[model samples]
Target: MENNEILLKPAMSFAVLKILPLIFLALLFLLLAWYLSPFFVFFSIGTLAAGWYRLLYIRKSIYLVTPEVVRISRGIFFKRTDMLEIYRVKDYVITQSFILQLLGLMNLTLKSTDAENPVIWMVGIPESDVIDTIRDYVQEARKHNRIYEIN
Candidate 1:
């Protein structure tokens, strides 16, 4: 069996999945404001604009999905990378708050056996299939002990 050690990150545009719900809630406020006195319009506009910025940020936060691992990298001044080995992974978890559930989005956590440490989270995975695919690959890595690349 090959050793599996790598990082997996959320797919690009995942950030959009997060900002969208806020936009909706903001819209709700805007509507309420319009009903009351139009003062809430600014809040709605600001939320929409921020959501659009998130969409653009989502355009940039790309992920590298490989056979043995997934890599998340972004930013020029504060570039960062996270790695998680498939073999080291212990289980999979999908979480969503009431708002996230309402938005049809979720956060996928790849939990390792390290009890003292926190699990790695891939936030804002919109599609259930995307989460499933990741779980499948992680399982496959465990099943065959797939070798992974760190890059």
Candidate 2:
């Protein structure tokens, strides 16, 4: 956390894809409960709970990019944090699906030398200059550490 310069949080749009279906199902169940049996009310409650869980899970994720390392923190009940040295970053890719493009969000995938999590995906990031900022930091960190990729 030394001089951490940038912090990125996934947009709530990340949960839309996942929760949308659940929401529809919940409404369907509610309609069925209103017209048919009361047991469907329980199903509606369950679907709503699942949607809520997904929202909380997505909301809890955070990404921090520092000059020396990238920190990823995610979890709902049990928090887990991972750090990838900026110098270890080998490559990165930005992907935008049709829905994400419509939402003005993109996913960033980073290939790094970290053994535990070599490929990290940061989803629902806004379409912005974050990639350029990270690239600059990675270059600076590699130069400062005197680290060079062979291939």
Candidate 3:
């Protein structure tokens, strides 16, 4: 059908969970700077830099589900893009942890036949019918490709 229809773009806020420890350490360093040597301020800056790096990495990731394939592009300095043919998709699972539920986000994991990247996780996806859409597309692709599951 059409080429590259955008499917899901996860929110950058997903990085919050990943970078939370760095942020906490940065705050601690800041507190230390207030009482101890000013050099602790530099440590705080370093932690913040690390957090910023993680934020950019998450912000740059994209998940696209097309009629024939699923495209996942991720990275900041070294970008890598992966494509999983929809016909190769075997199953999918959606999960929402307690913190993710509170943030109104969920994770979508796709199981594929591709040997190199069999499992792909789409995190921080906003709550919606995304799984349904992907499932529909997977079926359509399988039909179009004449793919059948023997087992």
Candidate 4:
């Protein structure tokens, strides 16, 4: 209800974090301006465009928990909102690629036990630690069978 009562965690963006190369390339282009090659301008523009997309993609990557379910929401192009009852969860998986592992990020997949539809996956979680946090929340929700409130 109140901002003070909510856990406002940091929103991590792979775009922002992974922009080191773009920044370097932009700088390199500027530094090598004397040469004035078309490639330099192209690279510089490309880097800026990428950085711009990433910046717009930024959001409050967060999952809010209540007494019933877990509500996870995030995205840049397609805003996602997942609401799953803790009891319906059949399996929980956490995966990290080589690049993600190096960057300390992970993807979380939640499988529900329902017959027709049963799988939900969230990508680019920005931090590997969210797996633990989400797992712990699931456990607690299961213990009490709580429902989540979605915004």
Ranking by lDDT: 2, 3, 1, 4
Q: Per-residue lDDT tens digits of candidate 2, residues 1-151?
A: 4554788778987777768999999999999999999999999999999999889888889999888878999999999999999888888899999999999999999998889889999989888888888899989998898888886
Residues 78-136, candidate 3: write the lDDT tens digits: 99999999888888899999988988899999998899999999989888887777788
RMSD of 2: 1.8
Better of 2 and 3 by lDDT: 2
lDDT of each: 0.64, 0.89, 0.87, 0.63
User: What overall lDDT, based on C-alpha atoms, would model 3 receive against the true structure?
Assistant: 0.87
Clashes, model 4: 6
* The best candidate in terms of lDDT: 2
Candidate achieving higher lDDT, 1 or 4: 1
Error of 2 at 67 (Å): 0.5
Task: Write candidate 4's Cα lDDT for 1-151 as tens digits.
Answer: 5331223232354556656677787878866764766567777877788877665554455656444565667676788777667566667788878877787776777788656448866555656455555566667766675555345
* 1 against 3, candidate with superior TM-score: 3
Per-candidate TM vs. native? 0.51, 0.92, 0.91, 0.52
